[model samples]
Target chain A: MELYLTKNFGKPNAIAMAGYLKHGGYRALRKVLKKMEPKDVVEEVKDSGLRGRGGAGFPTGLKWSFMPQETDGPKYIACNADESEPGTFKDREFLEKEPQMMIEGLIISAYAMGVNTCYIYIRGEYATQTKILQQALAEAYEKKFLGRNILGSGFDCDIYVHRGAGAYICGEETGLMESIEGKKGQPRKKPPFPANFGLWGRPTTVNNVETFAQVPHIINKGASWFRGIGTEKSTGNTIFGVSGHVNKPGAYELPLGYGLKDLIYKDAGGIRNGRELKAVIPGGSSVKVLPADRIDVPLDHDSLTNAGSSLGTGAVIVMDDTTCMVRVGVVLAHFYRHESCGQCTNCREGSAWLHQLMVGIENGQGKIEDLDLLMDVADSLEGSSICALADAAAWPVQGLVTHFRDEFEEHIKTGKCTSPDSFRI
Target chain B: MLSENAKKEIEREMAKYPEKRAVILAALHLVQKEEGWISQDAMEEVASLLDLTPIEVREVTSFYTMFNMRPVGNHHLQVCTNLSCALMNGRGVVEYIQRKLGIEVGETTGDERFTLSTVECLGSCGTAPMMQIGDDYHENLSEPKIDSILETLK
Candidate 1:
């Protein structure tokens, strides 16, 4: 169980460059600069089978390769620090505790892609995290890890921190590029994917903060070593941010394909207050919810996808027996409704409709016919918008209703929530 | 109007990006920091500084939840009522703050000391039932903790 990401968590001043250097930081950047070529770095990552830590889970090396090697103008690398997905707070840990690790990783990625500039497009709400990153960037620049020829490798690069203004759609690759361009955080239609045309109309590649954080380790430990840690399709360890009804709610750096049951009981100290496990959102709020019976599934990208969910940001949100599924629907639907950027007609109108229906059900005014209506609305939202925001909105509702239809029915039949008010607002 | 220092900060941010339009968010932030909210005049001033139209700046301002188009109290209490926080009784925290401050969500107190809001999520779910006051997150909230935090704030 070699910890790739959280190994330096408890170390003193791990956010500082000196603390990171003491813990063998930037050696990967130096190694890449000295021995390995850009294509070698890219191939090593592809060989490791490392996927994006963001929700999409695309192969990282293949993505880096997509950047045109012979681009005429300035190509860019955007490190997405906009960790806005609900139940997913693992990226915040790296930003606050191990900023240098992620920064070093970003530098290596910039070198691998032959990009001279990288922008860490962080969310606006992360004001404290932003300040820590700024300080860490200053330290990296002073030590010659960033800017000009780094460690005398003839690689010139500069990383900038761009703050996003409170929009979840900005987490979308194209939407992020738009925000970085100082415009509304709206998603553009793809086919002109980011690798071909991105930020400021130049070629760009965006990786999650944790995705880039894994690069330094993969280079230092080699590809086969990383491939040995996690499941076959999903390689290496990831930070799972567990919250809600779990007794010990926090980020746990576990190898991919770890048991969800163990993650809840052993790592997270089981359900809070000796409550029975009712349901779990294995990934973030965007993925499908798993009932208590499905907890035996190994947590990973492929396994979770096969088990009717995806490992989205690896944020596990647990719910105990006392929780109300109707209320859960209301909460999730409300979030999607509020955060939708109002670009596509289906997402803009459909998210509101879904929220309205969920709210009616929660308020004891829903008819049984509304159940089918909810499903129809949720289905329409999937793959119908300019970005995945609509799909993210749809999945949780579908997950809740698909597995916990009885709860929704009970509310409509009895005209009141049957679950205890202890967990409800 | 933007102050001299705000303009300087905006200029520095402008140099970081290839295009000047990209500094609009930073420029808007500077205007809001100095004036408590983004005024029409401030938007116009920022637009002039960044070579964007006032409507362009206004559209960007309205799109984001953080930029205050109108005035706010000295302390902005943004409670996260998203799923994780809701499971941890984030609504209770919002209600408690409402009773204590004598202001509901999206309302400023009569004395203008606190403005209460229920935000979506602030990414502090592990330490849930949290809220952000100014730039700092007040997490793992309880009745007593909320009292102590409010006492210190005023």
Candidate 2:
């Protein structure tokens, strides 16, 4: 049976909470509050090998350990609910279906990190999601899962919900911190990472909604049991928000090393309408694209990286043969350009330049060198900024050009996208 | 600039926060949602309600793309031309709407009935080539579908 923390989302709210509790809901927080030290909780998570479910996939325990242990200053746990990454909707599904589970997980993470206060920075565009999360939070508070001396352990933590102004950059940890601070959602430089200086310049830990939601499971089930489920490197199951030309395009919570081919063919019901798979963007749009022939590659982090992609955000977006790679490149370029935050010169100008070039190519108004120019601009922008937004803008372009240069050349030479009628640009 | 009901709504939003200035953007969102854009007086009223300076409210309104600084047509159509939608011919739909409405992107129709603008993403890539008007999504758009949509709006 699938050990679902968030996958059993169809049950009624109360029933789901009951089921979660039966499976050990607040037991982790209760244990920590009653017996374990904050550092001990952190050490457990560190030993468990739980990583951030957000795009970066940093070790959650290590992140918690980064906070100053001896400091009396206020520490924070900001849940990054701004699931605005393209092709990534797992957080939304998780929050909407099993909100209590998320709340319980947040409480556990708060206890682990010694955070007395937490914030859920939801995307403003997700008005419905914000409402759901707010209602759940209120319910949690009323049930004594949040606020003031939880379960008589004298561990007090308050959770707040802050909605972002519909900017994708706010999904970034620093940008989310900035938004919580009531500023423009632009990312800050590292070194003063959230562990050292975050949320009002105090030690903070920003974790994705899924990352926190997984804590209860990890805490309830021993670290070894949790570690045994997935590969040694990337432990635990992940919620894959599979979209695009797939027969069954929805959220699938599966083991970490689930075969890409099995997910594409068996689980997702294969390519939609029997269309042959052309490419798959393994982890949202930021990761490099993997060709159909390489579907045998496992879905774990290391395997994906070895196959020239990162298992980013666990968003599997599959493309079929009836799709134009140039057009795809153009679309991603437009997103990066529009959501650049305009903070640094490279991201601001480079995203626009890439978008314009891709638009020219897609519209059949291009020279051959535009392809090379696209790569050059993407190369220049990668790792050249304070934030990864620039690199996020560059990755898809690099993938499209690197893997499908022929498709781009065809568009330039034939002066038209060669894909079938459905994929016409 | 804001009606009594709108002012009350802004106050309700402000009440949700310990710091009134924190909800200024939300109040602005309400004002824009009702009035279709933020006016000078509306910004001033928002500032007064939030105990912030008018300049502060105006800056907040000006910074975000979702907030409109000027009046738009009755139908605010935001087309998603970003990657996934672009793969499914989102630009063609945008061009088709622009030609049919005789207004470029960011321009309102001559009669102020419709306005077109391109956005990054609407988080609904499953139904690619989609546009949002108000809160509703019109997806899987073709040139003919775009024409019918405009006719219905008319």
Candidate 3:
């Protein structure tokens, strides 16, 4: 229904400034700067019930209001373009197609936060995406949308595109700030979150690319209009990046409280090549997995959480019967293990531990008690880390075993795999 | 030693940030582009230019898998072996490329043309079963398609 983000993606020359403006781009930023106060903008977002789309699902406007209103020193806005979550690609597609919309969204958020300098810390693997944004940023600067007085509003701002060195932890707000500060991307402890002391110990606010892209719409169309879409509490549309066995695997902007089954069947064109669905990772790799039997649940933040999973980054990885759940567990565990920044002892050690156990199960060398051991290890890692990386690493392994216990146990008992395996390396 | 152009590029990146160290990633990118890998001398040179210690440069370099501490082939083949890709024949594509190139994972061909690496997710899961050679991504891979892609490469 009423696409906000992906509407402009398929258009020819959507990357060009003229193409973007032709489709009513920057109207929200113009409206926000001309007709609304910063407080009003934040309040509008708050009333809209727009939550952060970057896994955490924190309210966006409330996050903006966290920054000190009257900071004497410089404040910052870090747009986390470091979309490194496995099975997540919605933001990359959004940025690649509608770069201007993301920029406009960030500008509006910057205005709401009174942040003069903003940094889009994108993943380094996105060498091409980085260039596209750089060119768009240059065009915005030339057209006076980014530099000194933007459209003669007497407000000065500059946005910089920072490249992350292939670190997934940089997706975290504090890890991102540290990377920008010229260090390894590691998560900092909370208490003084990015709102109070961030980006060189000043006030800061971090938001996802899609989260900001929705801002212009919230400004242009009233908060109540946005609230009309999606479920109560989880308002507005989210980009569900469906991949793997789906026939049409791409980014679909469905209303938040939409059915997960409908998303796989209708939106993603159902399972590929007429294969029956085996399992699904409703969110990205971090969240729990839902089996084929449990596809009736609504795919939103609250519902997914209630169903014992999460709508993380809205990355729906659909797997048909051809996919082995045990192998899926192994792959995700390996990813988190590789990505764990060596700061927290539990995350650093436990991620590797989880991976080894998964490998054991996959190779048909696992014991029956290892199943309980897997859950126990996952339980231990739930709250043992300084950041959520440990929890993110632990969730998939726990999810696989909980839903597909028979499959995992079958691997252990039969000393063979249920599906064709490829990752012998 | 960094080339004059590399140094100039690093300078431009340094100006964008409030501090010199913030440009380390950008500088590393430039250095890797120029040298194919971040050499010890290159790290030391970058550290000197950015006012950071050489060990600090090494730490950042070794931390991220993108930066090649050792030398690599002329064409680097980074096949994404993560969940999405692995499920959709991503590992098969890697195996195909390895067999075609007459090399194994993390190996360089005798001609120094192709370097095969099975990396983490490259965020191209939408077009799964994919591999990245330099800046371009070769997705929706098959055995015949791998032949055509490799033919275009060398």
Candidate 4:
């Protein structure tokens, strides 16, 4: 099937924009503004089985429905462009190539949620993306696609681009909201999700950049057509950012339930330099690892979950035999340790302890029982925080050590890494 | 109130917010752009400008890694040591800079040209072993690349 979303990548700027316009760019917003009620827009989105692309996989329509429907306070639609998950770079590419699509998505989502002002909280390091998006927003405003009385539909909305200061925790919805509000970006306690008390204690809906980008498509091609692309449970094409030990390592927008083997072998052109695949982090680094035997599993959210993993952000990190599993654990643990917002005790302390222990094992200083201790620490941090940042830190360690306990044991037994000579920690 | 220049820059940011205090962080960013780092006086000034308390300004400043509370060098080197970068020898790149500069993380060089800090992911995983010197991303870095980058900065 032809790729609709990323089809215009690398084309001439005007041609791309024209193509996007032809294939229903801002038509969804126009339709919503002219024909459908805001409530109906929300209902249609809820009917379309679109899920959050920022690792959580929550239903997009359900999330939009959470916003206070009758509130008179200023509401916000925040685009969670802080895609800082370890191996996720799809959103960055999407924004850099077709930023107007993302902007249109944001505007449509904002109008649906009754939000007049919106913010795209981009990662600070995405300098190119920020410039492109900001430029796109300007072009959009000049064309009356963004600012007041958009398209003469009597619906006024403004979208702003906010840059984050390179914090992974900011990828969380509440943290993104806090960061956009010019705060520290630590996650706040729940029971007041962003749908209720967000962006200055008013009602707000934080949706992932890709999730919002899908709105225009869903509206343009009716909800039934959108749902027909992927699977019954996991619908539509997802952009999988394939990296690590792969030949064609780039973002491929494929159907959701595409086979893992087909993704790696056929689409990615198999592993680089003819190396045998050892494991794959199907989602970003936060999800559980799957061994080579599970490569035949479909890459849908439900399938991966049943296979003891998640299709998180669609960042397929392929690992080969040359890689040391202990080193992978150590490297990922170090990230969680550094990125923890330190708002909650378990996450703040547990991530560091897990890192120290993983380092000890990788550096040949671990006892055999340290494996259990690593799991124990990860367990303590999981679900013990205000947001999923802690779990993002904890789950990978738990998965790595659980699936590759033999590698840790081998390291402890040999007092050194057992991988090939080039696999140095 | 903030200075005219600061206010103009902040007004652009405040336009993004429904409430003025929502742009407190942007105000602090503008203050840092002018003053190099956030001083207590600058925080107080920004608080008044955003109609927030000085404590609120201070809390916001201290919370984010990007905002420097005290003085820094003329240039700030933010090396990304997160997972993807680490897989590509990010740790080694950071160590090389520290040894060459003779200043540890969070310290300015003796010449006051650079302040090196290891940060979380910079979201450029494709170009692993990346560093952000100001707004520019120096990605796929090596020892030679690092030497050239530092030399140009100096």
- Per-residue CA lDDT of candidate 4, range B75-139, in tens? 99998776667666677888899899899998998888899998876666667778998778898
**Model 2 alpha-carbon miss at residue B64, Å:** 2.3
TM per candidate, chain B: 0.98, 0.93, 0.96, 0.93
Per DockQ, the best of the predicted structures is 1
* Collision count for each candidate, in order: 0, 2, 0, 0
Query: What overall lDDT goes with each candidate model?
Result: 0.92, 0.81, 0.88, 0.83
DockQ of the two-chain complex in candidate 3: 0.72
Higher DockQ: candidate 3 or 4? 3
List residue ranges in candidate 3 displaced over 4 A.
A420-425
Q: Candidate 4: where is the Cα deviation over 4 Å?
A: A14-24, A420-425, B1-3, B95-110, B142-154
The most accurate candidate by TM-score is 1
lDDT accuracy of residue B110 in candidate 3 = 94
What order do you get sorting by TM-score, best first?
A: 1, 3, 4, 2
Please state the error at residue A184 of candidate 2 in Å.
1.2
Better of 2 and 4 by lDDT: 4
Off by over 4 Å in 1: none
Which digits, one per residue and each the tens of the lDDT, describe model 4 over residues A185-248?
8888887777888888888888888998888888888898888888898988989988777777
Ranking by DockQ: 1, 3, 4, 2
Candidate 3 chain A, which ten residues in sequence have the lowest lDDT sum? Answer: A416-425
- Judge candidate 1 at residue A248 and give its lDDT: 97
TM-score of predicted chain A against the true chain A, for each candidate: 0.99, 0.97, 0.98, 0.97
Could you give candidate 3's per-residue lDDT for residues A117-137 as a string of tens digits? 999999988889989999999
